[model samples]
Target: MIPGVSINEILTLTSILFFIGVYGFITRKNLISILISVELILNTSVINFVVINKYLYPELLQGMLYSIFIIAVAAAETALAVAIIINIYRRTGSVAVRETETMKH
Candidate 1:
C-alpha cells in the first residue's frame, strides 16, 4: 500500500477508464469524439505506469520517464489528428465518420 491508496484500487480505476475510452471509440461517430477517446486511453496508460512505478519501484525514474515520453507522443498524435480532422471537415463540411467514406474529386 502506498500512502492511502492500494494497487488493486488504482488498477481497477484505470481499467474502468480504459474500458470507457474503448466504448467511446467504438460508439462515437464523430472524428473529434474518437480522438478524445484515444487521449483518454493514453491517459489511463500513463496513470497505470505512474502508479505501478511508485509502488513497485519507488527509487527508479523509469515509469516517470516513460510516462513523459507517452505524453509527448500523445501531444504530437493529437496535433496531427486534429489537423487532419480539420482538413477533412473543411473539405466535407462535417466531421462525422460516415461522411468520410466518399472520396472527393
Candidate 2:
C-alpha cells in the first residue's frame, strides 16, 4: 500500500512481539527475564507510535518524541529495577520472585 510496506504488516509484527512479551512475562520466574519482557512490551508501543506517525503524519515529530520519552523512561526503570533486584539478591541470596513473597525473616 505504502510503497513496499503496509500498516497491517507492521501491526501484525507488533502484535506478535507483544504476545511474546506477555508470554515471557507470565511464564518466566526469573527477575531478569521478566525485565526483558517488560522492555519488549515497551518497545512494541514505541514501534506502533513510530509506524503510525510515519504513515499518517510524516510532517509531525510527535511520535518520534514520544518514543524518545518512552526510551528514557524505560532506561530509568531498568536501572531502578536492576538496583532493587540486586539489593534484594544481596539480602536474600536469590533473585527469584517466589523468594520475595514475605517481608518477614
Please count the clashing residue pairs in each candidate, in the order shown. 0, 0
The candidate that wins on TM-score is 1
- Minimum summed lDDT over a 10-residue window in model 1 is located at 96-105
lDDT of 2 by residue, 1-105 (tens): 269999999999999999999999999999999999999999999999999899888998999899999999999999999999999899999988888768658
Which residue pairs does candidate 2 place in steric collision? none
- lDDT of candidate 1 over 25-96, digit per residue (tens): 999999999999999999999999999899889899899899999999999999999999999889999999
How high is each candidate's TM-score?
A: 0.93, 0.90
Q: At residue 64, what lDDT does model 1 achieve?
A: 87
**C-alpha lDDT values of all predictions:** 0.95, 0.93
Compute the lDDT for candidate 1.
0.95
Q: What value does the lDDT take at residue 35 in candidate 2?
A: 99
TM-score of 1: 0.93
Residue 60 lDDT (model 1): 91
